[model samples]
Target: MEITVHSSKSVKPDYGDSSNGDAAFASADVVPLSVFDKVNYDEYIFYVYAFHPPSPPTTVLVPALAKTLAEYREWAGRFGVDGSGNPAIVLSDAGARFIEATAATEFAGSVKLLTTGDKVLSLYPICDGAEELLLVQATRFRCGSLVLGFTMHHKVADGPGMWNFMVAWGQVTRGVAIDPVPVHDRTSLFARQRQDSPAQVKFEHRGAEFKPRAGGEIPGVSCGNVAVHADGEEVVVHRVHFTREWITELKSRASSNRGGAWSCTTLQCVAAHLWRSVTEARGLGAREATRIRVAVNGRARMKNPPVPEGYTGSVVLWAWPATTARELLRRPLRYAVELISREVARTDDAYFWSFVDFASSGAVERERLVPTADAAEVPPCTNVDVDCLLAIPFAKLDFGCGPPFFFRPGYSPAPVAGAIYVLKSFEGDGGVDAYVPLFSRTMDAFKKSCYSLTPPMADARL
Candidate 1:
């Protein structure tokens, strides 16, 4: 797809009805970076949306949308990226970004054919500068479907925070009051006055063992049965669609065999199913060690001064569940679901509150803490990793023109056969779109073995 940039400029915060005289929103020009925000440092979390608006012939979409977004706290916050690329956000004076670009493609086709590494992603100024906390890009497709998206430094806000801002932007476009107004007081997790000791703040994330393990061979689970071989160009991106009906059917099949008061969430079911299927496709043996890494959002659960309803910051923790390839493949899907559900349940107020002190004390220099009720279960070996951004309301974001039908995270950090990104379905049904990158052979096997792609089976009685 060909694209051309029109204009790019910094947008200052507009303290209009949204501010409500709140000091964090109205007066505080410099918002201090919190522990979670700083941990991400200079990195960014990107979002892309495909919007089919009513006024297709109008030419003022970008400017109007840009104006609507820059008025809120989440957008106006500025990042202070020192030479090291670690970002800091200012509260009020910091401006967001306004970018206008034109894509030489139809909107629907653009959404269907989009990929993380495609050239169409060049429209955004992701690598342009470090000072801006929020960057906005509006691409007018030839078919008049506008693709609106933003890139926020991970330090400024997490996934939920980012979506909150986007939804609020939508509210503004509809001439409605912003509900659950953004509370930029990041002190809900950390104190504003406490100073970070110069030597205490560290950036390196490594293991805590006396001797960190070397070599790619993970020993917790045997690897003889592994079939994963996606590397370099051999790896390809493919999406597996799971309808609500099929998911419910799959979950029932797995849950029926297990006896417990607890059940699996949709996300747990999908991720576990993918893990097991991918492992099977890669031909990993039943005994080979396998692992899944999940990033959990810690907001409503935190106690003491709970993170406010509209607080925007990177409030997340990574939880890992390790199992043998046999356990993942042979066991029912609920087994993996149980592991994930339990892992997520372990993250509570104490865990996050402890993290505040843990981050400030420079404990990461010694070891990375994996919060779990059963720490004994954590494998002492390398784990196959899958990054998940599920359940966040991406498809629900409606900017007065109805909700977006497609949402793509823009980029992938993992190599081929190395990642799993689950989001809402393309049809906006009660389903999921699992964006996976696997090697050619593995993906082929996955297509054959995984029933997630098939249509829902009709009931026998029906």
Candidate 2:
């Protein structure tokens, strides 16, 4: 129930030698962060790994504890990204200024930590001029359980890339063969000078309206960039659990509604249902326009030569699906499901190529992106973001002990128009994790809304 923090331990990868002794590969002096890594890129990534029921008590020499820390230090260094203690990401006339990555680890204690499977999130990555690219926190609980969490700057790597590195680290912890090594070839995403790609050329002409921010661009946040806030307004995170059985029921309902003409994936089905429910809860007019913004991973979708499987840095973009609330709610859930699918399908190799060109335009990109995340008030149109947790692979991260009991993304404080995060369910249960954050009034009504009591929801909020 109580937690106390101590001094932080800075894990500076020996820049001279990436591997202090034994490492995955030889390190480089600096790994250039790709343009994608800078878009709306949150300075810090908050992730938690739950390893409960502590490895049965074992007798170990005092030196073993220190040795484990030393080993972890070396293991953690492998991800410091070319051994930079921190990330240098401020843009300046001098070809973009960057700072070192202070990726350090922390120690804490709790009496009731890991007693329950509730997912708690906090942004631990420091953002002030004094920043740490990555900060690992180890919390010891009275129950002898542990939750290994870390916050890393998005400048280093995005979710998918970060998790892949975690998986490889787990393999090393177990002394097993690691899978695809982490690749730092950011040039794969760099824009071309030839302007030969058709999609890239087309993207250059699209009006600014189609971009992220009206006049701003992506990820060019200020030194003290913070979540947009409102006067006396608040945002809260809620873990809305969807059971496997319920997802099946929704799919079945969707199939039935389609007269067995078509079927949708669990995500599409759930996304459709929530899209309608959230719209209704907001008390919006039936004919009000609503849209869903989804983050798309372009790693495998790249054309010709795709980004390597274990490529480092961010490889993501957004896909939008919009329709009037009346249209969305009036039609069967299948309609929205199809719409979401169609918009998502639009993201491919060509789309990514187009994105690089769009972002490379510089100031226009910044003009279009900042307003979306920084505007004092949201536009009249209702836009909700849906985050797919599968991309992060939280459940599969095992550090020689076992898979996590629970995992969740860091808390998001975006001004509460609304956002939905879909993640794998807790250990067992065979369900899904939907971390939804909305305006207070909307959530209050949502909990008691008919949607929560319906068959698809299984009448539970776990």
Each candidate: how many clashes? 17, 20
lDDT of 2 by residue, 252-315 (tens): 8777755677888878887787787777667666656788877778876886556777675788
> Residues 1-462, candidate 1, lDDT per residue (tens digit)?
777788787766444434364654455555566767655424555677777756332234444444555445556655554344443464545567778888887776655557434543554556444567678887778987777767776656777877777887777666677766777776444652444422222222233111232335321321111222322234466778888898988778667755755567778888777777777777765556777777777786676666787886767766667788766665667678889888777766666665666566645445544223111132322343455666676545776678776577654222324456787776768787877766666678788766753322222311
Looking at candidate 1, what is the lDDT of residue 168?
A: 74
Candidate 1 wrongly placed segments (more than 4 Å): 16-20, 55-78, 81-87, 91-94, 115-125, 128-131, 191-235, 259-262, 285-287, 365-390, 394-396, 412-417, 452-462
TM-score of 1: 0.77
Q: How far is candidate 2 from the true structure (C-alpha RMSD, Å)?
A: 7.9
Query: Candidate 1: lDDT over CA atoms?
Result: 0.61
All candidates' TM-scores?
A: 0.77, 0.74
N/CA/C clash count, model 1: 17
Lowest lDDT 10-residue stretch of candidate 1: 218-227
The number of the candidate with the highest lDDT is: 1
